[model samples]
Target: MRLLNNLTVRVLIAITLGILTGYLFPETAAKLKPIGDLFINLIKMVIAPIIFLTIVLGISNMGDLKKVGRVGGKALLYFEIVTTGALAIGLLLANLIRPGDGVQTAAVKGGDISKYTEQGAGMDWTEFFLHIVPSNAIKAFAEGDILQVLVFSILFGVGLTRMGELGKPLILTFERLSKVFFNILSVVMILAPLGAFGGMAFTIGKYGLSTLLPLAKLMGTVYATMFLFVFVILNLILRYYKISLWAVLKFIKEELLIVLGTSSSESALPQIMEKLETLGCSRSVVGLVVPAGYSFNLDGTTIYLVMATVFLAQVFGVDLTLGQELTIIGILMVTSKGAAGVTGSGFIVLASTLTAIKVIPVEGLALLLGVDRFMSEARSITNIIGNTVATIFIANNEGEFDRAKYNRVLNQEAKNELADYKY
Candidate 1:
């Protein structure tokens, strides 16, 4: 009874039952999408405000402006290096595995991907950066634009810091407001299992398990690559910083399950940030790195974009040269940064990359439509882990982390697990 009451266990059960329900009664399962959608909307409703207050507090509390710039600079540089490495790995593995080779494109069903392609055609790399500075802060908050909100938060925090003692009252008020929002979030998280069930059910019901048969190899390759990236490459990065990857994963297990269930990393952002702070990362680091990571440091999406592009090239029998492959990397480095944590954004980035290259058929995107939902879980989980590790790394580097606190929390968690086991 105690185990059944656990949210992680409940979410896991919900995912399994959701799959079964979709398989047995897809029509009923299809109707559950709104359940997931409503849960996601509830999450989004609080995201902009939480980000604004948390960041403002983090910055205003930290008196050093130069450290803020340094942290942000280091984060962007790290994102570029790691994501580029991920792209290269994907390209290398795709060439070696040839997942799309000898595939039957004729038997495959293609969807109307023109919307993605049209969006791709209109994707301006310059405009993406320029759009980061919002013309109107009200519209930015109303729309839940993460980038714009982030820019404003940083500036507001800086302005408040300049006010010194005068800012204390406002900071206290924001602190109270932050607590209120987080309290509300705790209430919202109780419904995670239903969101998990509805999200999984809708995917399986609408797409059906049989849809994966035609593209099993591609799906397998993608999952395998992500697994390697997380455990191998990301693990190496964490080890260099003297942090335990397994420990971090264990700490954030609940958030990871939420991301897996919903197939949206955004669903778990606030919770993940809170957990990171609890693990001893500074508020300034978590607030800055996580939100920025959503836009800039998409390791999983970068891997998928590169691999999918190369896979399509093989499917169409368009042989890419060494120079062409390098060009693909360069192109993806810019375009992949535009992909958010949302589900369909990966396809948009891929479409934009293909449009830029022109060697691969943009229509190849339709080949992926069926299996994309299934792979989204992989992408989202990887992304959240990547950002979490990034925060820990940056915090440790800047001496903002509390190792004593981290150890204490981990020990307490271990004791709890032992008690739960004996129960």
Candidate 2:
């Protein structure tokens, strides 16, 4: 009974119940989607404001312009290097395993991929960069455009910094407002179990467990690759920094479970930011790196893009030469970055990558449509872990991380909680 009071234990039980309900009574479970949607909406409601406040506050407090530039540069560099490795690993594993081999393409159910294809077609790198500079900051917030909000926040913080004494009061006010939103978040998070339950129910009820049969190999391969990336690749990176990846994962197990049930990384974004800050990353570094990582550093999505593309090629019996495979990697490096940390954006990015390569038939995506939702948990989980590791690495590199605080939090010696909760 005492264990039931713990949020993590409750969420875990909710997930189990959701899975069983989804399997036993799929129709009723499908209707439960609203509960999940409401929880996610509540979380989303606070995201834009929290991000804006954190970035503005982080930058204003730093007081060093060059450090910001250096951090941004290092972050971008790290994103490219890490995601590139992800792409390469995905391609390598897909080739070695040949998950698509011997599958009959004609049997696969084709989804309405036209919408994704159209969205992908409109993705222009130049326009993506230009879109970051929100002409109307208010509109950006209203639309929940994270990158745009980030731009606005950075500029606002820089401008506030320039004002010196004039900025102090405003900074203090922003800090207070930030606290308010976090308090709101604490209340919102109490509904996480319901959100997890609804999300899992909708996924299983809509898709059903039987969908896994046809594409089980593909699903298995993707999951194995992600597990390898997290445990092997990410572990080595953390070990270099003298941190245990398993310990970090255990520390944030609740967030991972929520992401698993919800199948959307965005559902846990605000909490992740808060947790990372508690883990000794400077707010500024957490602010800049984690959000930007969402946009640019999608290690799992990148892996999925490569594997899915190759899987489609093998399914259709289109032999990809060494050069053509390299081309796929090149195209994925660009298109994969366009994949937001949302649920279905990965399929769109995969569609666009195939269109760019023009080697594999886009219709081959039909083979994956049924199981995409099932694979999404893996993608979102990997993405969240990647961003967390990036934040810790960049923070440590910039000397902005507090090792003592991290140890205290991880060792259960200190509790990072909000005491003044207001309704």
- By TM-score, the best candidate is 1
Against the reference, the lDDT scores of all candidates come to: 0.90, 0.88
- Provide TM-scores for the models: 0.98, 0.95
184-282 per-residue lDDT for model 2 (tens digits): 999998999999999999989988999888788999999999999999999888888898898789888899999998988889999999999998999
Judged by whole-model lDDT over C-alpha atoms, candidate 2 comes out at 0.88
List ranges where model 1 is wrong by over 4 Å.
341-343
Tens digit per residue, CA lDDT, model 1, 120-227? 888888988898899999999999888899999999999999999999999999999999999999999999999999999999999999889888999999999999
Candidate 1 to truth, TM: 0.98
The worst-scoring run of ten residues by lDDT in candidate 1 lies at 335-344
